[model samples]
Target: MNQPASAIEILDTTLRDGEQTHGVSFSPAEKTNIGKALLERVRVDRIEVASARVSRGEIEAVSGIIDWARGAGLADRVEVLGFVDHGKSVDWILKSGGRVINLLAKGSEKHCRHQLGKTLGEHLNDLRANIELAREKGLAVNLYLEDWSNGYRDSRGFVYRLMDGLADTGVGHFMLPDTLGVMTPEQVTAAMTDMIRRFPHLKFDFHPHNDYGLATANVIAAVQAGAAAVHCTINCLGERAGNASLAEVAVNLRDQLGLNPRIDETHLVQVGELVEHFSGKRTAHNAPIVGEDVFTQTAGIHADGDHKASLYHTRLSPERFARSRRYALGKLAGKASLLKNLERLDISLSEENQHKVLQRVIELGDSKKAITSDDLPFIIAEVLEGKDYTHVELLSCTVTSSLDLQSTASIRVRLQDEVLTAAGSGNGGFDAFTGALAKILKKKGLALPRLVDFEVRIPKGGRSDALTECIITWACETGEVRTRGVHYNQVFAAINATLRVLNLQIQGSLQQSRSIDPTA
Candidate 1:
């Protein structure tokens, strides 16, 4: 595709339309934080903060954002949604310190007659009155033609009449919303092209919904058809399915359509995380750009292909989004995938050992078991030795805890003929166990990596004693390592994984330093 000379403007509505997702709400501080992130970090051109007169809390939320935007010299770039309520919404907007208002007006004849119970002339007069009132209040107005796509299709005369009436209103922009998300990309392209040609001087913004999973596609189509700006929500959050996903749209424009998008691509995942934290709406693992599995290569053939050449990948590079590519070992994992895993652990395996280990990995995967890099050492020992390997072993462990009592742990570890014991107390039994291990490593002048992440997953609808899988990611000076443990007890699995991570860090660091400096 031929690249465009300039990037399109991105107006993020995560704080407004995104909040409309069922059971999602952001507190004032969260709203302010997200506003800052979207503007400064994500580098979006503008943001729609909230709707006017929604609630006292919403009023305060917009106020907080306005105050912050003013200090950051971004007040002019911030916007709020308002209704044509004869100065009611304008008054709330002014009091909240918002300078721009996205005025919502009836677009289609059906909405005018059925929803507002007004004739075409009456609806135009009411909108004109509201626009005049807002102008008098010193507020910039951008008009939202709610259901505009439907208006263009089913009621072209009514839509053209409304636009002709507003031609002299000095509105900043005309926002066309596919409110029902019913338009295909072809429809969007044709409608947008016609509107831009009909109203050559009017700036157009395209807002798309995701009910049919084509919001991103429709957004690209509109941009191609001459939209000056595109509206998106972080994490694709909105009513019903969602709005166009900001991350997905931005990436698509840059890579697929060859349109320059002025976005800080590295901050894409961070924006998704902030939105997820505030909105409490989780992003699915397979969601386009910011999803957990989007960058993870799951099939072994794909992993091998990636290793040889990145032919299996799309233009969406994980590194551009502040994420690393990951290869998931499963029933489909091949030799290339196992080699990559071994390389991360600084372990070398013969071709014979590699084939044997690959067979076992596939068997475990076929049985629905997940394997991590940390499990490879034990697997190697078991498969290679054909018997239990006694290189390092846990001799004994004792844990004690009670309500309102300090938790304590004592552990004995054996390395061949040498045995070491350590004891400690902590806020919880698992913490106590980790504390004891930390003390033992300290005695050996070893520094363990800090545990940066911990997650526990228990199958749904399982019994109380159902197996729990604990995954932990530890960050050391060298790099990050992940380990997994499974047991019926969640606490036990976490503790076990923590211990293994610490041990691996200590041994790996010691070996590296020794190789570098023989005197040590």
Candidate 2:
């Protein structure tokens, strides 16, 4: 039989430590937004937002967060990192309207000797004085033993002296950070166990960085060894390799350690994306829980297995993270993959037609191109219209554009066994092509749809002849339609996309004409 799950408090430091990441400084507005999302939406236990006395902008960001947190009655959950400068950091935090100070103390002897040039007694005295000032000023305190891993490893006596000196300071939590991210899981577990056993009356929060890529694993070991809380950041934003990812830590704590962390897992991706945008860092597509492609399965066997009683499913389903599972369409896709995509679009096809469409999809996938769901309708039309719809066809086209000159196009097209050619000049190549096509269509008493948007993407390692995909969105009388086309030249890609749209309209017109009653 399984045991009842343990509970762990989540302290998020995306703003404090995360801001330490190279070239990342969240604006006051961005920090406030992320802080709100972290507390109100994702509902972590606490959030450490910024360091004390960084700048006026830092003060404003922390003050704004305080305003928001106060209105939501969660002011105590907001925290800030502070220095042990004999109440200098405490005064700065108070000016920012912050209620909690995570006071940073030297956890290693080297930090004390080399950096502060203070003996153990002198450092402990300064730390106590700072804590006393914060307490007298009516601010809650949480002391951070920065580099606690090294302290415990090299000089446990110094660590013990610091803890013992502050034992009765009425601190809310004692945060132990593997500050340099240099602790193994076993070392973390052992250290946490020893600390919890020695200071059984105090609360402990384990903070881990990802320099070793073991922060998540080590955090779990700490929690399992009886730490009351664990600290993390959104999207693993921090100095160097970053901190343990909040999403990964939360989910793993729940599933691996059977520890019920206080986090709204569904909003994990929302926070991840919001942080990425503000920090100007792109999250990897394969990043667990919050990545774009984590939920996409691209194997034929996997899709088929899923269809056959969901054999490939797991507890980490996309729905658990407020996302849906996707069966990728490519050369590795099976008929089941096609069916899954078609089902999403609510379109059904006969078995014979399905086979033909799948073959075409495979051929297109072999070209090292991405096929989006929006491309499905165009593919369906082309495969079914094979050698049948002579409504419109581009027989030939020539376009030229030069600097400081009018761009020109000449095109020959066939409409229902009648061939016509036209020439036109415009501002650019695609515009010229459109102008020629418009004139030719006007002669046939046909009107084109309104082009609302045009997007283009070229794969990396580009050359003049590299394949480019053009996606065009049109607003027609009935509804909006999207089409895509790939070509070695960009203007030609747009032209091919335009041709697909024309063919679709012609087919629609033909269908409507046939639907009318002959007697009427």
Candidate 3:
């Protein structure tokens, strides 16, 4: 492999090749959003957004992207895929306001001979014609060798001759694609090195598919072998196993190979999510760099190591990508792991209390799945506040949820020495209970926290009597707050969690008053 270069260019094809994933289609607005995100936010070098003449909607999407790109001074960074069909593709591209055209040409001898039924010389004439037409139309041009890997392997001379012939054509980039994703890293290195050695003046970009699942590795090899750029799709969206993931390839170029890729690492996850949302592709939680669970520490040893000595830490810290590391609370959590979470929550516990909490966490982990930080206050309240801290208590809650009927709740609460009862109804039992609680809290001049998100889950292999954990995220005046409640009944679990939050707020209010007037 050649010595590393300063930086490699990234061409994102999430809107073009990525949209080809089976059952994935983006609306015109979605296309514009992704295109803008790739160029403006993620800061990829270039983006191939659509194929020429695909559809009216596609044209509309391209027009929208071009309009934004022009206003943002990024019009030149956008590209469209075209074919060597005389001037039709170029005309289509010009109509869509595309500035760069990636012209698709036959790369493999088999494709050229069998698919196109044309001689190599005849194909070159058409390619040259198309390039000249695009240039005449004021469009920059790149060439996509649809199966360049196979072409180099089977007919090296044919591949060289094509480059030798077109070296003077003033094409902006020669995009070499492992269209079938069949090349190993070794093959990619050797072929790309040979291509660079022979055509030293030509700009080359490597595009790898994931059929062999070595697309990222092959991309690294190609870059090391002196390819100027690499093409990728977000969330690895493409046909078959997909293309190399833009997130994986980009980070590898930076972190592993020590080359500058002009992507904003912080925006990778955001762009991946946008593509996933619009494309309807579910990203694997364990996917490198952009997966949901990639930043979560599951093992107690790993968490403890990080806390003690930063042992498990690497340069690939989550903070670098605008994400926070998570020490998952589960069966695998140690005291150190629990400490990390408590420190984050700004809650301190005695050593003995920490041990008790750790044991409860482990027990719950064995039975259930995720337990968030919000659950800790309830556990602490149960263990420590047996009598004190009962600012407001739910004396009784009776909810009726039945088929084809609105859920109703009758709740009685004790605030200090007084008892208040209220009845309310909603489409769900939890909503009904919250409504009743709101009515009673209104009488006490206390308002409920704004519910932001509610998530519920049961234990693994949950039996009929398994405990239900209800986690609620609240938007408080200070910030966001999360609380958890586990109970046999789901609605009761939510109520228990809500009560903990209410008590916390009430206690906080009392502390504030006390601080203002110590004499009182």
Candidate 4:
């Protein structure tokens, strides 16, 4: 019988199998950073850092990871994948300072007979020789039965023979991979259960691929059927459809199966982002746990439920992952959604004005998707035209740009009663505008807030003339604020967004002064 609630080990293969992702490669420094984060911060049980003898770069990456892991008293937890080239792979691993080697062996008869052109006996001899050499050198060994899923399905005898030959070899973990990601959850459960029942003493780990989008689900099945550990990759970076997502697998194991995985929940998204940045792969906005929009409430009703009584809450709270819940404001926004966003911004409005703002937001959503909360002030200012949010405004501006040449911006702006002219140059038009704007603000003994994130996009399927929307995030004393601007030209859009930030800053200062002064 399978245990109901036991600890499951997580073996992250992002640096090894994950590098097989198309056009994705991590440098030695990147690998070291990721490895440190995984073992020190995210706290996965084990990490497979690289493949042996791949390159001089691979050696450097593995050696760096091993050096750190050893100093941290986690040398045995770091693993490197190696081939069945007798002593060569073992020697390479030792050269890289790795203590554990995940040896790749043909699991399926077809792979053995066709790929390696070796019979079962010959392959067993090679695997035993490699295992012996690893044991003699004081290196831990884990065997990967590559394509174990099909091997068990097509020819159980071959799998039985392979396991029989290596059953007493003192291997740490026998990792079974669904190499083509062709197993359904039912199949995984049956195979994993049978393997456990048959072997009884050997530790088995299930490695799943996401070609069928069943990697996480298959992990659940494998765990329920007694897999001691499961393999995953950060951000699901792997060949074909990728491997099981480390975040998804860890969360599901805890929530669904009552299993404890050695994962630090708060750092899941942090590590995912690190991997995303280094791998140059953009995770989908809706990807679970680590996606940008995963914690955002898009539906108005959902926000309402959350606002009234936390009806829409779950154990998967964003706070658990060091993130905050966001209510998206768009055409689907309602009174509750507006209230939620208003609450976040510490802004209070009359019911009538709130209604007005909601209507405008919906109207904008008809053309745009979701208006960021940073954009709310602009919408509110426009909806209540009586409000004085525009304490500063740009009177006129001209920007010029040419390829391979610095861009220049000449701007004339009215700061209260004074008109100022400033010119500046930069690598791009927006940069030039900021340079010029900085000079103007410097005159007033104020500096613009540091820019944090800038994103520009257009309506999906829109033409070249389609309006460009630029949302700029800035670091302020309170925290962060985002301002949005829309224009046909992308540069102008960014400039408009920047102008909005300045107006808001000036307006806030005036309001603060008024509150402090007895007479003005």
Kindly give the number of clashing pairs for every candidate: 0, 0, 0, 0
Q: How far is candidate 3 from the true structure (C-alpha RMSD, Å)?
A: 4.0
lDDT by residue (tens digit), candidate 3, 57-126: 9999999999999999999999999998889999998998889999998888878999999988999999
Task: Give the TM-scores of the predictions, in the order they appear.
Answer: 0.87, 0.81, 0.84, 0.95
Worst 10 residues of 4 by lDDT: 385-394
lDDT, candidates in the order shown: 0.87, 0.89, 0.88, 0.92
Per-residue accuracy of model 2 over 282-398 as CA lDDT, tens digit each: 898899999989988898789898888898898888998899998888888889998888997777899999999999888889986577665676678779876434478889999
Q: Higher lDDT: candidate 3 or 4? A: 4
Q: Compare the candidates by TM-score and give the number of the best one.
A: 4
- Residue-level lDDT of model 4, residues 363-392, one tens digit each, is 989896568887788789889884536666
Estimate candidate 1's alpha-carbon lDDT, on a 0 to 1 scale: 0.87
Ranking by lDDT: 4, 2, 3, 1
Better of 1 and 3 by TM-score: 1
Candidates 1 and 3 compared: the better one by lDDT is 3
The model with the greatest lDDT is 4
lDDT of 1 by residue, 452-492 (tens): 87888888898888999899888877677788878887778
**Local lDDT at 18 for model 1:** 90
Comparing 2 with 4 on TM-score, the higher-scoring candidate is: 4
The CA-based lDDT of model 4 is what?
0.92
Higher-ranked by TM-score: 1 or 4? 4
